[model samples]
Target: MEIAIIKYNAGNTQSVLFALQRLGYKAVVTDDKKILSNADKVIFPGVGNAGAAMQSLQLTGLDKLIPALTQPVLGVCVGMQLLCNYSEEANTNCLGIINTSVKKFVSATKKIPHMGWNTIYNFNSILLDGVKQHEFVYYVHSYYAALCNASIATTDYILPYSAMLQQDNFYGVQFHAEKSAKAGDKILLNFLQLT
Candidate 1:
């Protein structure tokens, strides 16, 4: 199947590519509107600041193109955060594909960035099929999306927040599914099976 991985200023493209390779799938990393629009599925993988990422998407006109995609689209980490309406990180407005807001963790007890493995539960979509609840997934982010109507999964650091989100064909994961080992691989496989 034709898959496209949206290339922007965000990092982790190679990691995601490798993950797909292991899954026996090939994907092209591009910012070309025609290529992206023609792909059967698209992956938006990112690890960077929200403001800078948005700037890159804007430069390539992907900020507008992404939200309009007809095929299933997956957003990882900051890429997921960008799918929300707004983010407290860098005071930036996001793609607004999901009706939620990203907020900074303001806890003095727990560590920032919420690094390392964490359990995700409350699955509400087919994206988590064959994946058990409270399964550990790798995460490395300082900000989190607030629980909203689109939230399909939840994870906790200082408090509960969206671990996964889905609205129509758009799906967002706040964790690095490519790096989450078995559980992550299962999620990616499930996303690929979407039709």
Candidate 2:
């Protein structure tokens, strides 16, 4: 299977690549429009600021290319945040593939980043296949997509937020599925099996 990882300046490409390697798939990281559109599956992995990430995608025309993807596309962490309509992180507009707004966490404890492992509920999506409900997944994000119509799963931090989102062939996850260990790997495997 041909899998392409959208390479921008957002970071975490190697980690996602390692995860796919463990899964027995040799995925290539590239920003070429033809290579991306021709791939069987695409992964957009980001671990950076929303505004900067969007800037990178736009500079290379990936901002226009990503939302137009026909095959199944997965966005991780900030990559997922970029799929929304807008982001409060840097007052940036995003790809708008999911039609939801990403917002900053209103933490009462001053814990802005919301780091470490968190449990996800309402795992009815195929991406969570063979993974147990309420399983802890590694997360490291200060912002989150609000619970919306496209939300297929939920996770509670300061309040309930989207753990997983799906709209047509686009899917987004708030946590780092690649770094979530067994549960993460299982979810990645499930995504690979998507038809």
Worst 10 residues of 2 by lDDT: 104-113
Q: List the residue pairs that clash in candidate 2.
A: none
Error of 2 at 178 (Å): 0.7
Model 1 Cα displacement at 179 (Å)?
A: 0.6
Clashing residue pairs for model 1: none
Those runs of model 1 whose alpha carbons end farther than 4 Å from true positions after fitting are none
> Per-prediction TM-score, please?
0.99, 0.98
Top model by lDDT, which number?
1
Q: Candidate 2: what lDDT? A: 0.92
